[model samples]
Target chain A: MTGTEADHARHNARMLRIQQARAKMQARRTLERGLLIVHTGNGKGKSSSAFGMAIRSIGWGMKVGIVQYVKGSWETGEKNFFHAYPDLLTFEVMGEGFTWDTQDRARDIAAARAAWERSKELILDPDYDFIILDELNIVLRDDTLPIGEIVDFLKDRPLSKHICITGRNAKPALTELADLITEFGEVKHPFKAGFKAQKGVEY
Target chain B: MTGTEADHARHNARMLRIQQARAKMQARRTLERGLLIVHTGNGKGKSSSAFGMAIRSIGWGMKVGIVQYVKGSWETGEKNFFHAYPDLLTFEVMGEGFTWDTQDRARDIAAARAAWERSKELILDPDYDFIILDELNIVLRDDTLPIGEIVDFLKDRPLSKHICITGRNAKPALTELADLITEFGEVKHPFKAGFKAQKGVEY
Candidate 1:
């Protein structure tokens, strides 16, 4: 309703140029290796995005492993849904709870260590194609886990195993080694509007 | 290994204070309503994260609806996975293709309008609890669809129906009206490192 024939033709020509440039870019991008994807920042959807990737992997019949570092005590919707895919997905909940809930540094450190051990096993395992270290960044941010060892181990993981680490305030070292880093910045939240977290959405 | 008994006691006392404050804050957040979530910016996982929320909603036995505006032509893993839940989901693919691939302004607008019509139906449908409008922002950014009418319709949607709109460059008007807005910013990407999109991970 808004474009003239001349305008349409001009738009078509501009799109043709873009299509050709995209083709050139696609031709140059030939490398295919597993990526270290990091999702961090003070926003929602860090772990949700990882879980979504897990579903996508399961759609293609690829094995997925997940380790929760700081959100294990509560029964979440994602957990219940992922439990349906035992053959294709292995989900390990290893956190005691949120740091505020736990309130014990020693116990938090112990839980982080155990979760990291499990994560390392998943990374080294040949059967899994995708592994999600859900909220691992929280542990790293609090210095509950050793970053150097974790980075070294991740760097040496299987060439075709995609690993996703998620949480707010990801360590700079980890982001430096990541192939993809998506910082989920929160522009607004319901909590600020005097609303509590709802079921099937916030969890 | 990191703290003495006195230090541990001090930490526990500090945490108690924080917990008390948290409880007081929680007491104030009592409102409950559906959320209008927007995922936007130039990064990966905007749509993937919305898909994840759909899975989370499904876990809680909630019905879902999805409309793919610009991604309907491709056989995405998400589309394939979501198709498994025919009983609980209404999946609509109503795009000719990407704008470049279509290169027809009139056709793109028609497809966008058609998709928006379907989206409105889903939003107003009482049976559906969650609805995802995938890549709708692209068409909005291109002015293929009328934003004012769409925004008005969305603002008047059911109070208990959660809606997620995902894509890059989301309209400022939508963000201003949204309950939650997560901007997914890309710090690094595999594509920049000469890596082509993978099967399960990318699609």
Candidate 2:
């Protein structure tokens, strides 16, 4: 065979070896169950990634429950769009405001307790397939809620229920219970570059 | 004042100081313009987060365009969902398959070129409010497309158009030109724990 033909033969042999190895690796991945996903760190896309997962779940006719623990009850673009799917999605925005806005630790703890009560119900409900605890980490970080209690409950959740938690400073207890964790780091931000948060993009 | 009253008074004064500082900071953020956003690294949600941004943009009655450069022409949950909004979104999946599946360098380069041409058209179109170039970073990393040429074109894009690119191992030149960059790191993945990818959640 010519040099080009020899090179083609070697490439084909290498590819076959890779394909076989991948198939063997895939065969070992047969376990299927609900996952505890955590998205945390000081960057964008933590909540947005959860929102995207919500869209994917709804696309497959799955029921999704979202309980926003820290976001104020503002008119967000996501909330407006998600409202169109009333039958599939139940979105409950129950926050008095940020910690500074409320300036009352007692009130903040009360709000977190109320939100957790709602989240607990959704997590236990059989109708819901996915539950998004948006920014629940902030509540844990501020010590508004007991981390041990929350972690214990999450650990004992139903086997077929998928739960996603999004926010910065995820507690070590929570991360240890998670099946998947993605830490988003900021390399650059427009806000630090003198740009105000724009509608639809930053919301 | 009583002891409790004095404590409340101090809290109120501290809250007032924080509110004033935030107000002063918010005053300096007056600039507004489009953003060149990049999502990269070795974790999930790079594409999913971009899809979430598409939803946010569409929620505000903005037109969106998407070009999937590396994902094969399979039925994805996001693709099916976005198809419902034909008038508002233009979804294009241009890749034949991943490089391993295709196994042809010339063919891969051709596919990347085709996808880039479509992306260029969307970026230049004034009617589009947001554009997503999904997995274009993989194309740049593989040398399927020249990084310098892509960077130069993006540098000259309209100041009022928002563009988002998502994939792993994003080129340094691209990130340097980006207004916002997020690096997603994997702490733990379910796949490593012997869990197969689930429908609606991993798609």
Candidate 3:
């Protein structure tokens, strides 16, 4: 079976049009600035995406600083694997645990404040090229730290540094400042099918 | 200004409900089979997600085999950084380049077939725990290889092997067999603003 002559002609025409659109779009894009990116949604890869970006940064010999909020001191595959890049990646896991695990509003707030303190220093420091605020949105959602305050701090951040904020339920105000936003929508998760979140894979 | 008591109560109630739903979901999931995962859509970071998983798998001391279907031999940061894991990670850049660059259908088909041959060997060999097929969807889009060949190959694969296929417009047959599928919806891309794709980040 084969496409008719008309069908083939139409396909070529469609391809040509798409090429033109892409070229037009590409020509207009020339700015190169550090991006404020947000990864949010109910999907499993939000924080994973952030870590992935961190790896990419490290691969390029860029210095990376990471502050983990809400994950606490648990052992994670990313933290362990990225240990290989000590000079390029500085990782700090500061949260006590998830909000549910802590169950204390005051403690959670304090931990967030401490993590944000670290985050502020990382953002301000000139040595780091990329900073990842892992799970900051979760803390923001719990109101442990005011979104406005964080946004205000980011306003004057260095122009060469890229920042990635990952978690679910990001506030609208944060979204406004993000140059790139990706919502990882879940199609099917094996956990719902009774697949335990195994070490290395889920972490 | 502090929230009223009603606001606090509403927040706690919402938190409680979320906790309950999470607990219920956690309880229902008990299966532990290896997954066929697909990362597809117009968004960025699909390949980065796969690389992140590769890092996780490496942390667990698992062997990884990677095949780049359409990304020809440009010096990639991943290739350089992951080179440190020579014993555990095997990275191959097999493509002749993007189809537009090659502009030869037969040449594209041959390059894709060679890559798939490598992919088949990787997936079938017991040495590899995880195999990543980067940009396979693009080759599939151009009919470089038939979808049925891939689906049939995956059918009899090891029960404990995890395979990740990344690219836009994944074939429906592959999606059908995939245990987890994520559509990375692009909210913002720097290229639209005229920023070119950078080495580490875009690769």
Candidate 4:
């Protein structure tokens, strides 16, 4: 319970003012174009968040191209879902394995290069409205491809195409150039308790 | 180009080791109870991630119940998709608007209480395998209802039902109680550049 009728009336008046201001701000935002989005940090849901975006893009009746650079070998639930929608989505598992699994540095680099080449082909396709470079930052972090070179290549990407990159330690250059970047920070996780990641939850 | 045939063989051996460890870890994690998930912080995608979970849960042939606590006024893209699945999903918009729009603190509290009551009903229903308390953290952040009370009530929730609470600034008590907690940190945002959050992206 707040206060009297006068307090309620005052609050209502303030809300009106705020709504009007928001309307003005909303109207001023007229430009609509593709966005470079990055999801990075030391928490869970980085890849899942990108997969969420991929799902929403399909919800909008748009085609999505996904290049899984660091998580290539595993069978994921999201991948299975995408497989059901062959017409709207193309999911390519390009990485040899996780960094720990693919311990050889040179092999990892080669896989990253191949994945980037596939990304380039996907980005060039006018049919795709959304292209997800899943865990691409791990490749960049390994120096398989220079972050600057990727940024330079994406400079002239289609105006209406949105590209999302997800991983830990996204390059500063990419973050600066991105229209939106979200970092998933760890608050608490089951892994700390030695609870291994299960199929549906982890994948 | 990476390395020779010998290098490839060595890499494959490492991959096998990693896979065996992962498999052992996976086998040890046998707890399959429904998750109490919290998605919070200043960055975007908290709600969308939960919506993504709802989608995935549906993919598993489970019904989902959604209560939009603070974001009831706006027409969201996800809501539109859920509308098409009347038989499977029950999306109830139980708030007047965002707290800013509904500036009366008393009214906001009342709305939150009403929504919580609805949530209780959904949580009790065995038919719903997944219940998303979308933006419930924002309602709790305002101290309308005690966060501890909510967590206490959820402690003995259904064994097979998963509940996801999403919003910014989730209370420490709730986070501690949650099985999984993901905090979205802002690295970059379009709003800072005066670009409006568009449909499909923001909604």
Off by over 4 Å in 4: A1-10, A102-107, B1-30, B86-88, B103-110, B146-148
lDDT of 4 by residue, A4-105 (tens): 667767766887888888878878776678888898988877777776777667767778899998774576666656777799899899887776676676
List per-model TM-scores for chain B.
Answer: 0.94, 0.92, 0.90, 0.94
Structural similarity to truth (TM-score) of each candidate: 0.96, 0.94, 0.90, 0.86
Segments in model 3 whose C-alpha atoms lie over 4 Å from true places: A1-27, B1-24
Candidate 2 lDDT by residue in tens digits, B1-203: 88866876677678678878887887899888889999999988888888888888888888999999987546777877888889889999997687666666567778999999999999999999999999999999978899999999999999887899999999999999999999999889998998888866788
Angstrom error at residue B47, model 1: 0.5
lDDT of 2 by residue, A38-76 (tens): 999998999888888888888788899999998753678
Task: At residue A88, give the lDDT of candidate 2.
Answer: 89
lDDT of 4 by residue, B34-145 (tens): 7788999999888777776776666666788999888745766677667867876899999668756777767887888999999999999989988999899887887777
Query: Model 2: which residue pairs collide?
Result: none
- DockQ of all candidates, in order? 0.76, 0.60, 0.44, 0.43
Higher-DockQ candidate among 2 and 3?
Answer: 2
What share of the reference contacts survives in each candidate?
0.70, 0.58, 0.50, 0.41
RMSD of 4: 3.3
lDDT of each: 0.87, 0.87, 0.81, 0.80
lDDT of 3 by residue, A42-120 (tens): 7767776777777777878889999999784367777778788789999998886776655556667788999999999
What is the descending DockQ order? 1, 2, 3, 4
lDDT tens digits, residue span A1-203, model 1: 34587788888788788888888998999999888999998888888888888888888888999999987456788988989989999999998787777788778888999999999898889999999999999889878898998998887888888999999999999998999999999989888899888876788
